[model samples]
Target: MDKLDKQSRTIKFFRERIPAFACIPGCHDCCGPVLASSVEMARLPRKSEQEQDAALAALSCPHLGAGGCQVYEERPLVCRLFGTTPRLACPNGKRPAVMVAPALEQRVYRYFEQVRHVLV
Candidate 1:
């Protein structure tokens, strides 16, 4: 496979492997500024420079809506990792019944290191 195809598969692998858990109703405490790979960003709605600056200044995610994450389904791997790993535990103490395996988490981090990431 080409580089693009490999990266795409890697992204899909992590997305599917990451476990999901119940979050506190109406809670978005973990929504904040985060870095996303170009591949991930392409899946999200565009935000203007002004909007990006404003959200960064406030230390909030540009995609965080009044209700919750506006792009929850398309959120980056880091966003999905939140509350799923011990390192990024949910503020409300919510987590999957089984935490992400250390090896898997490290592999995700390694992927992040290999990719070009930008603030989202």
Candidate 2:
């Protein structure tokens, strides 16, 4: 398989994996502490954190606010990968974990445009 095919498979794999952690909509703080960022060092909350502060902290997405996920357009990788399995412990003291699924990948990419916008 070529590089494009390989990448496509990877995206498909992740889409299936992350959904294991289905994120309930309108839950206020679906993603707890350490909201995913694109600027610099923004690591997904490690399972080993033991204690996740659990606060409605500011997320890196320009789209996130009182209204929630605004930019939806220019979001980052992690946001795209939100709802996975193992339900990354809710930093907000909630149990049943959440996942992030932005359905943009289902569409085909342009010839010159290259990016896994969908199956992140």
Candidate 3:
């Protein structure tokens, strides 16, 4: 498969295997200062300068909408994997019944690195 096809498959598998719980109502504390690849950032909708400033000042993601994430479907793997990994568990104490397998997590990490490396 081509790179795009591989990326799609990887993301699909990762999302399916790594479950996420509902975040606390009206809480976006974890949305701040997230690191994402260029491809992931490109998928997100642009934010206004004022909105960007506010998000930066508040240390939150610029794409964090009033209701929730503005680009939920297109959100990066980091966003999708949030609250699933042990090191990045949800602050609200919500957790999935099955955690992502170590091998699967390693694959996801490889995907991230590959995407970033290819873009850069």
Candidate 4:
């Protein structure tokens, strides 16, 4: 689909914007063991590949430390798309809404839905 690159780009944009706008300059556990998705395993950079199997087995990010995401750039979609709020829901119902950049989710989901084979 022509949307592949664009959608990934969009996910990239929101991925950055979401964290920069919300959880910056604070203690963020975005890379914590609790919320860190299995997706993180697939996104780990090649540099960390040797540890991927171990990390996945432990379910602890190889790049994660006492501070935060060591390889934030190579973080997963869930990490990229996380919001500062404790929880988020939208008028769409079903899903609990919280404050987040609307355009960001749209872009991220676009990529996720389209390029299921690749990282969103």
* Number of the predicted model whose lDDT against the real structure is largest: 1
lDDT (tens digit, per residue) of candidate 2 on 3-64: 65665464455444443333356554653332322221222222222222222233322334
Q: Write one digit per residue (lDDT tens) for candidate 1, span 1-107.
A: 98778888999999999999989888999888999998888899999999999999999999998899999899999999999987999978999999998999999
What ranges in model 4 sit over 4 Å off?
1-8, 19-44, 48-50, 84-98, 117-120
Report lDDT (Cα) of residue 93, candidate 2: 47
* lDDT tens digits, residue span 1-120, model 3: 887666667667787787766677887666775666655565677667787778778788777778887777887788777777887778777667787777877888887766663110
Model 1 pairs in collision? none
Better of 1 and 2 by lDDT: 1
TM-score of each: 0.97, 0.35, 0.76, 0.51
For candidate 4, which ten residues in a row score worst on lDDT? 88-97
Which digits, one per residue and each the tens of the lDDT, describe model 4 over residues 1-120?
465455556555656566433344434444444232234344554435556556656666566666766766766666555553234422222222444566666655565555544211
Model 4, position 37, has a per-residue lDDT of: 27
Candidate 3 local accuracy as lDDT? 0.72
- CA lDDT of each prediction against the hidden true structure: 0.92, 0.37, 0.72, 0.50
- Candidate 4 scores a C-alpha RMSD against the true structure in Å of 7.1
Comparing 2 with 4 on TM-score, the higher-scoring candidate is 4
Runs of candidate 2 with Cα error greater than 4 angstroms are 20-25, 28-59, 70-87, 93-120
lDDT of 2 at 30: 51
Error of 4 at 36 (Å): 12
